[model samples]
Target: MDDAHRTRWTRRTLDWLRTEVGSALLLVGVVLVALAWANSPFSGAYEHLWELPVHVDAGDLRFDMDLHHWVNDGLMVLFFFVVGLEVRQELAVGALRQRNRRLVPLVAGALGVLTPAAVYLVIAGRDAPTGWGVVIGTDTAFLLGVLALVGPAMSNQLRIFLLTLSVVDDFIAVTVIGTVYSDDVRPGPLVLAAACLLALWLLGRAREWRSTPYVLVVVVLWGATVQAGVHPSLAGMLAGLLVPAASPEREDVVRAKHLFRSYWQSPNAGVARVVGLGLARSISVNHRLHEQLRTPVSLVVVPVFAFANAGIDLRGGALGEAFGSTVLWGVVAGLVAGKLVGISLGAWAAVRAGLGELPDGVGPGSVVGGAALSGIGFTVSLLIADLAFEDEADTQAAAIGVLVAMVLSSLVGAFAFRVARVRFGEHSADLPVTLTPDVDVERDHLRGPAGAPYTVVEYLDFQCPFCARATGMGQDLADHFGDQIRYVVRHLPLEDVHPQAFGAALAAEAAHRQGAFWEMHDVLFANQARLEPDDLRGYALELGLDVERFDRDMADETLAERVRAHAESARASGAQGTPTFFLNGVRNQGSHDARTLIAALEESLPEAAVRRRS
Candidate 1:
């Protein structure tokens, strides 16, 4: 297929995934089917299915694995690649971008991992040291699903905290699997693997811009890692790390847009193809690959893995023995008790040390609930169990523990969250949420007619992806409602998490001085990963602003203070995260996507509130 066709297909696939939340549901269904099949009279058929031999032979090169191992080691490589991309993006642009913001989660995740292992050792004794890695990870998919089901009534900051904590722990767990679990290291293959990694990094730094060499290197690196007795899956993470996470250079973006515009006017197929490819390249490699791969890995690969691995039969003696076994007790205690106490205490200590603060509208109790939620560790936990226990009986016992811990942890978290809700009442959630002060046509950023019947006060961070999406939706709403809606913008730069956010907010504020706040907003969101001082100044110059005045305004303490004051006001008014919108003085619930928000506006406002677009 041609480049344009491929791009269109990829975009459609990603769009579909965004609109559907079927992955977790599908995984659950597959697990249920696996369980039924395993306990049926045809249980031998289910067991034999996974043990069926698979082999590849090509001259001196050969590989052999059972169906189950292939699913774990071969198919799951894609899943790990997507994970690596996520971690890379977080470090480059998301919550982990700042060292101080990362510190709390770092501490929490370390303690979460260590405490669980420690608990496992204590319960199972030194004889079971090998299985101690079983309780180290959080199931991101399941946890995020639970949070979504619980809704935005909970503090959004808690969700972010849990997400960051899980991501850090997942990376650490992957590292442990790669290094600690490997049976032996072959020196020659290990050295070659190191060389391959170095070459990949150098190629990325040199901006080779071609995929052929990178793909070859990745294939070789995976093989080398496998030969070295390390898990080959680590190669995916190494490759993802080498991917550049910044937007393309300013010149490159300009050139690509120019080429696209030229092709638009002339209608040349060849020029259009080249422009398509160039536009694709303008996006970061990590983001591009992530967008393409996330849906397939989640929907197909993950469910397939669960179907193969989640089929432990609960026969008469097996179930009773597993319940009685020390290994099972260790797994349960490690994941349930260990994660809850460890993460909660870590957060508490972080606050005591002044290293971290709780999310607005969330208290210490809610944090403990969030800690309980962290105990649901199925995906990565199963992986560790498989690697740790070579004996079939031991592995089955460990699996039973993981399954029970997952269910118990989920229930405990839900119950704790309920308790927090009842105890804190309005304190646990943003209640009677109202618009932050300083949201005004005269004082703050404004879009659309000031006298319009509908007013949306958006507390936004210039660096946030969701806020960027909300900004675009705001534009569409303006176009849809004509002059019947007014948009107000307030700065709530999550500076601690997003390092460039404070500076970006300042730049927009400075541009507002030159009557170009919206122009600067567009530039910053379009190039979020490339928002250094020089880039901000260059954007001002490109937009025909006085460079000297823009720089002076950005550096002005009063302007910065104004932005900070607005942020503080937002926090006081119960804002937990960015892109929070208040429509007519009431918080907007649900997603801010164009369709959803438009319907919400229609319901919230009167029939005569909007003027239909001509």
Candidate 2:
């Protein structure tokens, strides 16, 4: 190569090296720090740093958490947030967009996740199933690092395939972390987290995607997550997803147009307008923080987290004990066995049933090999291990098993792909499948008189006290407005805490069968405090329904299915909780009195009045 070509080549090589080397170094640094802190003479100080008391209070609002918990629960949320972003990006434009490419990785990931989990469970048993999640994640950095070292031996297609698989793996891991390893239930913190997320999203949409508000919101969300008995890392995932990642070039153009308009409208305005002008001058200022948030999270947050949590001291026969322990073995087995079995079965079923086809340039052997690699569960496994085992020794053992399983799975996956490449001769073809975002909405109930000018949609959960209040108020509005406003009640039961919510919903549907829906609706809301099955039936009889019909319908599969469909619809419409309202298709998801709803209804009315001409 010539001197100029050499220079260009060297620079390009350095850039690639930087990315690979930087990520590796960061991962190594985290492990070293964690190991050092866990075993060092200054371990106390290291632990204390994480345990230091941090508090934020404004008037009556005050919250606190130790340093370590903040990092684990709070900072980890940001990690998950980034995970969500990657997922959204992949679905929008990456490997996940193609059905063929997507299916194989998904199948591979499913197998990878299940096998290890099964291995862990069979070893650990039902009591330790929580630890199953521990052996169910793929460590993106470590896995990618291994691939980079193998370099030229691996094809670019394989590398992309691995990346896509890892992204899906991360998605599953974060979900497990959020749903499975969560703390006890509390509405206050949950509500706060929801509000913060909404605020951040609105700020982004209004072109006010500044870092300050986002950061503040994240902190509050973290605190709320801690308070809500959920792993605080969930807040990070929520915040990250809401932060837009449109390029700086586009942002600059938008900002310039906005500023020009503002200046044109107020030529003679004083310093106040000029200061306001400064705010509009650069969308860069506002967007700079959000951009930083995304970059640092991947480069710093995730790596540090991996290092801190991944380290386990391997002295005093800890390795031997880990192998001996059923919990450890269970985790290892679940990841290895469950992943392979579940994934292979799911894939085979999909293909045989004609629901999906294998990817091009990929064969059954490659798929199986990839499935083996999918058994490499590290990140999520550790998280679940932390949750499942309160005993330090047990936890360490599970971690050791995870580390071993991950390495073995990755090796198996890489080898499998290599064999497939040799056999299939790189005939890459896209798989055929339907990929649609899952809609969780219930659309079964009466949608109001066909072309009614106004539609009032109410989200109600049988267990929520606020929803009960809204039910009574909604009925009043419906009666008063008559033909002017059509009322539509949507199911949105909070099932996580209230286990019987679905049953309660079924009871309401049963009453509806006997032409006493509004009456049963009132009774359910009125007596939300005491919603036993018998109580619901009693209310049905009091409302003049045939008691036998109500009982039969309550147990009816058709009625239950309809209720479930409605609940799904509510979720799709963004109804996170009960007592949410919507006026003529516009969302109004929260508690509001009759007057407030009326005002909203009037806003949608036409300017011209209807007249009776003689």
Candidate 3:
């Protein structure tokens, strides 16, 4: 090569290297500073800062929470809010805008989420498997950072594909975090958060408030949320969504340019230049800021979170023990095996059914491989681990499980991509696929006895106050309907929040063994607050049971198993919360009044009443 050509190439390479190094340094600095602050002698101060109490009052309800909790629970809402914005944006204008573009990522993401969870469940079973949701997320920033290091060796399309998949992965993670990882909520903080979000929307519409004011309000909302027992990071996601992504005067720039062109030949050329330049400059600055606001959140917030949460203690026998844990193995299997299997099967089925297609240069092998990689759940997995296991040992085990699964999935994905590249030579057309038809088969089956017109399914947690309220409403509905509806009581005990819920369920099942399920169910719901292990005997005696038989049944493993089976069935039927009702076999979550119950039952009934012939 000529000397001038070499010099030019070297300069360009050097500049690119400089930019990459600069970003790396900034990331490293943040990580180092956070670690130092967290581990230093001044760590107590850092911890104390998060623990500082903040209080808010609205009428009769007063709420307060510590600073650390505010950041995790409340601020994180904004994190999810931004995530929602990204998902919306992707569906509207980005890679996922097309069916073919979406299929690969969607299928891959589903596999990523489901596999790790299933693996976790299989390894840990019902009790310990609660953490299954934890190991089903992908850290987009880390994945992109790794990709960036590979530079031009990676295809531009592949980069875009990876980014799109990661964004979708983030959406799934945020939804899981919001729905699955929450505690029994207090109405005060929830209402406050909603009000704040509404206020933010109004401010955006007014377009008068600066981002600083919004940020401050967000901090306050975070504080309220922390006191409310919610993870605070959600507040950040909510706030980000309310921040405007486009300025009000975006159209004015085009109008001004056209007006300036007309003025170029007129007598007011000098004045036009001055006014047009000023307006253009202002518009440019506003547009730039607005664009920055709309930049992908996965690039910023996720990386910061990973840095903060990813640090392992790495001392004692903790590392070895984590590796040895079934929880960890379960997480690994779920992410690595379950994700690959579920995603591939779902995608193949979709293709065969004629509903979707694959991306250009991507094949089934590549898609499945990428799906496997998507199972590298790091962020959401850790959050689930925190929610699922209160024990420190269990938490560590889950973390190890997440770490292992992520590493395995990433390696597998990279290898698969390489293999696809070699074999397919990077095909440039999108591959199409078909989706399976959705049928109400489960709904039909749950209707009970071939000719049953309507099925009413009630999901109740033994310790829920709302479930107690629902018990009375449900009884009234059954009596009012009078053999018109089949009431199927499903156990759904919120065990994490109510420690005695499972025990109460066991007592109810024991009562069922003596053909007095309704009597026991009503008694248990009515006296949910007073239920103790000893209290079951008194209830059994009042119901005129064989006290010995009742006691024996209460202690029976079979009773506990039955309760667990009911709980699992409720979950599979999409009942996440207590007092969830399903009319005509359709799930309806949350407590309702007698009027609402009547309405639901009425809707479920056949249009024509069946007449019985005596």
Candidate 4:
């Protein structure tokens, strides 16, 4: 095959691996392979391989660790770095951006961790208190995969709740490992580590998106932390947080454009390279690193860690040894029973006491199921088991408990998710969607009167052929119902699938400024197949819009953000696809034909409200 085909195939494969189900399956498969290898006659090979040691010394610099330690203490740092990046993104722009919005997850996750650890301490305290931390984590990839297995009956709320909970869980786990579990923490090295962190912060400001100084500082930070007897992986979080999450300055974007134009016009190799560098700086460093590392971490680093760590011999009475033992059963109880009770009750108390609220569409049964699934604490639990136990027997027994807990937890979670799907009748997860035609009348385009009794809100991509099918529905709604129902258009562009969708939305938005949004909207949908950049400008001219102002408005990044915010609002409010409609604040699912739209309007709107057109 050609290089292009090979590159495309590689991209597809990496994307697949980065998905929840794909990562989960790969992780589980590696674990299975490890189990099989450890149990087979070739078990000696597995043990010997992980036990192999490597050492490095260069003048004053020295590093020594075994293959297993390297995987756990060394490679796992990248995994934690990715976690830090995710948390930063959430706090910076995603769901947890707002303080009140963050409260629920923070409360739920805090309770989730404390309850599990408390349960473990109560049950295993006298004999195995150290194992408390083992039950405190939730494996995000595995939990998400389990949810995926339950099918679309799972709502986005459950996914978000679980994800937020896991991010918090990981943070707690790392902090616990670094502070509570480290037996030899020295203040001197810790002070040095803090100095390195200061250096990291300074370097980040001086050279945004430059990895060299950051890497050097992080390397020293890791060594210092290791010397200080804290888990070296904590250095990764420190490094990750230093990477900026905000958008770059406009000058940066302008510089990138200049470089790109220079490269295009002059066609020099150096200019082309500078263009690449400039464009990289224009994007958020957190996002760029996250994307660059996700595939490799999911496909390579995680699987290797799982393979090295998950190998517990099932042969030679190992099952009997663990099944009959208190340490094993205590861990199982803590993970399975403790997580379920903790997440459920913790969330309940938080919600009841006004600290948190249940996510939309998620009822008690779904919460119970989700809580049970959080018990599948594979990655961090295994790490805890390693840290908490010195004896091989104890470690293997804890591993067995982790394995059993994971299996049982999944079954329980699936059962709960299925129950939720049946109880809620599949639509329980969707939030109520409403759009006030008068609210964003100036910001968004409106075809009919803002105060029409029955306002029809259409969330759609301009390039969507299905949206094109619904194009006539708007005019027909006006034609049939007259002023009784006014049509309002909102952009929900899917730029990945349709490259021109965002540009089309921008064209429509720009036209709204010139009081001709409907005109641009009509033409764009009609000729979606030809919405190139120049075609959009031509459409503005054809519609008699101020061409220069239209161009300036289209070029406005803030307008793009407005369009993006609208799309995100559409998603968060549970508009599943393009051509989604809401009549009188209620979503109208199914066919978007005029008849369906009219029928939905009749069913959803009160007669008094409909009669308000007079």
What Cα-based lDDT does every candidate model obtain?
0.79, 0.65, 0.62, 0.80
Evaluate residue 38 in candidate 3 and report its C-alpha lDDT on the 0 to 100 scale.
58
Clashing pairs in 4: none
User: What is the TM-score of candidate 2?
Assistant: 0.55
lDDT per residue (tens digit) for residues 1-614 in model 1: 99999999998765644432345556667888999999999999999999999987656757688999889887877777777788878888877886667778768878898899889999985657788888888887777666555533555667777878887778888888888888888999889999998998898788766566776887788778777888866777777777667644556666786888889888888888898888877777667778778878887888888888999999869999888788999999999999998998887787789886655565676777778878888888888889998777888899989889978887888788777777765334333377656366678778888788777888888777667342467778877888888888888888766899899989998998999999998888888788999999999999999999998998899998998898888877777678788877777767877787777777776553555532
TM-scores for all predictions: 0.79, 0.55, 0.53, 0.73
- Where model 4 places Cα greater than 4 Å from the true spot, the runs are 1-12, 151-154, 204-207, 248-251, 426-488, 491-614
lDDT of 2 by residue, 374-476 (tens): 5666665666677767778888888878777776766766676566657765333222111111222343344346456777776778776555243357666
Model 4 TM-score is 0.73
**Prediction 2 global C-alpha lDDT:** 0.65
Scanning candidate 4 in windows of ten residues, the lowest lDDT window is 430-439
Off by over 4 Å in 2: 1-22, 36-63, 95-104, 107-112, 151-156, 159-168, 200-216, 243-291, 340-369, 421-614
Rank by lDDT, descending?
4, 1, 2, 3
Model 4: per-residue Cα lDDT over 366-453, one tens digit each: 7788889899988889988999977777788888999999999998887876776777655345465555333466665566777777
